[model samples]
Target: MHLRFHALATACACLFIAPTLRAQTTSPTLVTATTNDTSAEQVVVTATRGAKAVEKIPGAVSIISRQDIEAQGLVSEDPSALLALQIPGYAPSRQKLSNFGEGLRGRNALLLLDGIPQTNPLRLGGREGYFADPMIVSRIEVVSGASAAQGLGATGGIINTITRTPTEEGTRHTVELKYGTQFHGDSASWKTGYMLEHKSSYDLIAYLGARNQDIGVDGAGRPLATESLHRAADVFVKLGKDFGPQRLQVMFNRYQADGFDDRVDVPGDRATGVPTTSQRGTLPYDAPRNEVRSASLEWTHNDLAQGTATVQLFKQDFSARYSGGVIATFQDAAIAPVGQLIDQSEIQADKWGLRASWVRPDLWTRGLELTLGADYLDDESQQRLTQTGRVWVPPMTYRSLAPFAQLEYEIGPLTLRGGLRNEHSRLKVDDYSTLAYYGSRAVQGGERSASKLVKNLGAVWRFGNTGWSTFAAYSEGFGSPDVGLILRAVNSNGRSVNNLVDLQPILIDNREVGVTWRGSRASLSASVYRSHSDLGSQLVVSNGIGSVQRVPITVRGFEVTGEWRPLPDWQFNGSYAITRGRTASTAGGSLDLDLGARSQGPDKLVLGALWRPAPGWQAHWTQSVYFSRDANEGKFSGRTSLEEHFKGYTVADVALSWDSPWGKLGAGIENLFDRRYITYYGQANYSGTAEDYYAGRGRTLTLSWRRTF
Candidate 1:
């Protein structure tokens, strides 16, 4: 029985780490590290790309600083709703900007920006988790399950982000403005930003930024029929230099979200969830557009061969457009009838990559360290039909090559990591026709390749006098499938693309265990995980058109996070999670079922409190809960007969900050008791479309101001 449920979840994670290893066997003192330690044992650079030290990394990591993303981007600038409010099996937040099936531990994650690769794995665009502009983020790491030390779409782990640097030396400038509304109407939003930095005098540095936003509505006051139309603009730049130890950098970013709105969708009453609108004016197409551009060039060397070398070269270009739906059916005879509505559709991608790494902390001895790297990608991607321009996802051109190695050692209190990766990929594709419905299908592409190696082991014991830590890991992840939705859904006619064969490539397999304690006031961490794949890809819609289905899944989870500083300016935080998933159809079969809402999401809790009381006032509060799901355990994907479900909710938020003298001021409120709910992928009746039923977004009030000079 799956090895007795993986040996009873590894004996309940070794009885929850055996009383923190017997209270760390007679505590003493030790534990000190600081850069103003923001806990979780600080120092992380995406868990082992270099920098390690999140208790020596071994599963479930999270960082999100920069003052917690400027205090949650002052209530939602949506980085997938701030990583589903601080990542714990993240996934939730379909406030629509398309992160369709926003996954993390259940698969498909690997978005990065400061470390290149903004997902487009051969045309799988779930909008790479909102690329850019969390006000030019300055931190956000997250590394959850599967890991081959990052190569290929981290089968459910890795979110990088990190941008904003210029730590002291000269000119600085900043300005921000925000405004929000909908406490019960006008539905407003506004944002403006600017930033600049310089630090010269020989070791140069520079940074720049820009931001813009406008458009809002919801909470039943309407507008936001399936979201999109929150106009956007973002720009970024960075440059650096420091030759003494060899360093160089360059970066660029640009984002744009255009406008075009006419309104449509107005269907509600899915057994009383009452919400879903838009339909009061023009409508047909033109309303969603997206563009993203990125660039990078980096190099570093801190005495190379002895190790600490880095290099990066990256590029990205993305495009999006959606707003015209309804595909399939044309009744032969000239191009026009039978449910015609193709209005528009678009997707484009271009990625370029190269990453290099080397780290060696006495590689051949003394506490070992090592880490070598190589990665390269070239993606092309495509999809189209901006009204009959045809070709619906048939450009394809992925290419990859990875090489990796990792090793960490530290005797004394144990810490022995291991890693290996190989990965190789190739795709190609050309010949294409489909898109006039099975009758116009032609399909016949070429080249397909794959290779894998993946492996990672882990350990971390750490007790150094007390602070406690424990870990256990085993990782492996790899992905594929979405090769432009299996070559544009080739409907057979002398198929090709290597005879499709379900476009293989998926290999998960995670397993984790964790524990952490940190005291002086209180800190806690906990984890238990399990992931499995065996040919898993599952996205099925059928009549509403969405494909990919290769069963055999299994996911399991548990997480708990905590912090408490009784007083001393007060602090309290919390987190909780419990996830479950299952599936089957072959490949070591017998999973039985239930793995849906686009792969499980729901079972969460979070609570927070922070009060600084004086020296620059600060106050924050939070509460979130979501737990409900059972419409046959949520397997919706074109479900009909109206039995959709998901119904537990509790939300609250508040914020206040001050540190004036012309610098900062903030205010916030979000869904604070406005109660109107329905979101968790809007109860997941998957595409029984009506813009996929929606709601959730009502009480909101925000204000902000910042300045620096």
Candidate 2:
């Protein structure tokens, strides 16, 4: 059964207003500029590894400025929620500690920090989105389709976060304080941070921040579980030096979060419409937690081989501790019986990489340019049981060497772009034994090597003096399956690590076309895309054993984004996206079955308004509506809960800010209508289990104050 599009009725008719924060005293605009002149451009570096105007990128690109970050932070500080609200093709946020089912364009999106990879593809614990705090970030660049610009793990797209830098000369101190609560049932939370910046012969910035979150209540005034309750902290520092035509910079950041030890879960009944709740109790072990540390050193030269060159050395260390589970793999005869053992899993990953690039303008003619780059990465990862001291996922080492080249040529109002990347990778594993539940199979391990070549081509044409542009592009992305999961659950009698059928790399083919129109006060863009994969990864559970399945898949979608400023003091922006996906029912069958919720999400519509009514006063309002879907009914043979049937809901948020002589004060209200509803993830991916049937947060109030001196 091929999936088909369904019509959605408009859910809201009332108009609301709010405001955003800008660095200067002027009011914020949805686009780059607010005046009648429409030529102002926003520059992005993630699309092609070099700076280029958004209109010239020849692809779908989105830039979330600092102003937008600060404004949304007032409502919620979670980066995953921010991205989900702003990006059109991104899946809805789960509002939890993990991003396991948050897909971009029906696939995993690679995350980067200042051009350094943040995800360990082999393990993919889904905590990569929490590496950087929004307060320390200056901007984020998003490319919305499959791309090979920066090498591997971009099967869907790319998201690169750029950190803040000293914009003013001299010494400055900044402080921020925020508080949020539901005003019921121990639901109070607070965050505070301090930053210092000094500039002279050398530029330096340092920041420290901490947050404490308590229990939460749903819209119906029911107490929810404490799965997301935790204590979080961040430490960041950057130092830079300038030497005429050369510059060097070093940055380091450490982020840590730990769950509370006192709370225990009270399972809910999905079939009876009950939500999971939490209560204070003594536990056998600590709760789930994540600790991440990253550092990078970059050097840039203006004149290297008659072109600009940049080199970066980066490192990341990550560890995640999961809650205890009673499973077959956790059994240890020496420690306890199969059903009596309660053990936890902890993933450890350490990565280091070196990336270098050079851009040469006017290669052969005035309008021709070329970019060359190479990247090297070495990653070591493993998973082990904390209590039993048993290795669940044996130690594995992976290394990759990728070299790429990109080209751009301009003629009159038409621009052409192309790129190619070749990646050579090797995986080394040691002989290990599977868990006793899997027949205690002894697996032989050795080295496996493979290579992949990906390419992209695009063209952008601009109409003469009309502020209109059209683009078409074809791109390919490369990614590796979760190797750690497969090696640990192998039940085969005589299988070698090098010959496992599940270890093959995935290659995605993407094709897109779009048009954009920009005016002094309004801008609109629309795009349609299709992506295909001969061998894609999916998680399947059988007989209480979870494993990875490779199948053929296809995803198609269309998106529209628009922004308009009917008046100087008021701005309105909106976006809509519809995505559909299907996969082959059998290993090599035709694509006739609908994809699961983990790969496909419901249609989303988001609208926002901003107003600056007074000199020092700003107001903002935003609303999101998810449409109901029932395309996959009666498809899973009663194995999963609907899996594709989703009930729709509406959410609204409002914020107000004032600038006083002493500091800036702000307040926001989330879930303004207090609509009682289950989250999209919980409804669409239900497993008929009480532990996963969760509800969205209730009406919450947030207050904040900030100052700089």
Candidate 3:
């Protein structure tokens, strides 16, 4: 029945798009731009630690304008709902925020706030996905692919969220109150903020926002899949003063999120006949809270004798807590198969960095633009292990240092971008102990260092009114090892887990090239990128150490996206990606059953439309489909291998809005077809299999209101 239904859905989608596919086969025009046109899009980025438009950088980048956020409709009022869908190569799903604590993918996109790192340095996992709020942002800038300068280990891309600034020379305050419903459910946001010029050469913008969601089950009356509360406020302060021909500036920001979701089992769990659903092992949500604080200083030389130079320094501190409920292995059904406990956690971390840049205005430097920078990381973490009626905590501390440089130059029709970075970090596990029967260990400390070089090179050609560009870039970065890999566990049989920390950090080298056209009516960008990994993380019966053995894998994929505005006020944005990741066995026995990383779902397709039929009134609609590939666990075949056959699913969304006396009013619907689907890379552990994997929310009706005063 699953196979038959999948085939039918595929056929239906093809039929629906058949008309658009066959009509007007004009010269293919692919478009993606981060900078606005004549009314240039408001562009400011911290992607490369720069205050310029992200599009000006020689890399693949995209933007999710604030206009698209509420128009596409948010689930549980989470921003990833609309943000992830706009970018190709990004595989997003509903289970994204629940299990992993955030909408994280194995490819690892690093998240930065304004300029501060949003990743929880103490924990390998980035808790930013679940904590992002729409009220505080002015725009979202993305630097696609490996960004070594952005973070310690980045495999996916860099997401730099820039906040609104103080009033330049206009009104200083605005307030918006919104209310909406999904399937008769309630969701709302109340925001009151001010932006204004301050003191001598200083500017500041401050806002307080509260967002709430009444989400529990699917519109179809299934168990509540996601539920949470979010109340956050942020203030951005910037002071700029002129010193001779140079400019000096200072800025600071703070953001925090606290919320919890109701218990929702993986759909696969129930499907596999394992009784996936249960009121047991659920979290009380009393343990969810996250805080981020950041501050930075910068100086710019506006009139360099020969060119321009910039220098910056910053410090970021982060902390988060998740009352992660009990995660059970199939056979542990006896005395503690279920419980409300946090098996994992990260205490906090402090990071500081510096960057310097120089550019020649007269080209006397031989097309040379130099940038050099360095950073330091101090992080601490601890994990809780539940044994025969007891909870034990193991502590760890980490430190890191890194420095990098890059030079870019252009001559005639060729522009080249290249850079290299060396990163190193040390992890120390402390005051650690386990059950004597399993493995008695007194306080023991362990340290590991990861170092790598990253570089980039790209070129573009110019012609009369049109320009075509193509470039290949390469970079190498390392991901910190999972903390649990070394921690010992006390099994149900009363045996202590053997030490497993022999594992190493996962490393990746990515290569990419693409073609683009910059024209008046349209802008298109298409790229093909691949990332190869060696000696990466593989799940073995995970202990506090390395898994049973080792293995290597490759993630090869393609993404195409474009934006077309053929007529005034009419726009279209669409993207599609076919991504496949595989791992071949190396040395080691089965770890974590090799059941797949739950993050590597199958193929994904997305389409978005923005139509302003009339001024102040807009209609937007988007649909995304996620595909899954089936496979047996390592124990089933005694090894890991790729199999053919696409798993199934499709989700649809629509929203319409109009200016109102109170504010902007709108309505929307999700999963209009009421179809069930699973994540491409089942994110819910074993719960992600066909039987227990998660599902899309059923038909939902939403109404919203927004006003700027």
Best by lDDT: 2
| lDDT, candidates in the order shown | 0.72, 0.80, 0.53
Lowest summed-lDDT stretch of 10 residues in model 3?
20-29
Residue-wise C-alpha lDDT for candidate 1, range 372-425, written one tens digit per residue:
898888888798877667777778888888999888888888878888889998
Candidate number with the higher TM-score (2 or 3): 2
Cα deviation of 323, candidate 2, in Å: 1.2
* Candidate 3 lDDT, 251-279, residue by residue in tens: 77766766544443443353342322212
Residue 684 accuracy (lDDT) in model 1: 64
lDDT, model 2, position 267:
91
**Per-model TM-score versus the true fold:** 0.34, 0.94, 0.79
> Which ranges in model 2 have alpha carbons more than 4 Å from their true place?
1-40, 637-642, 686-688
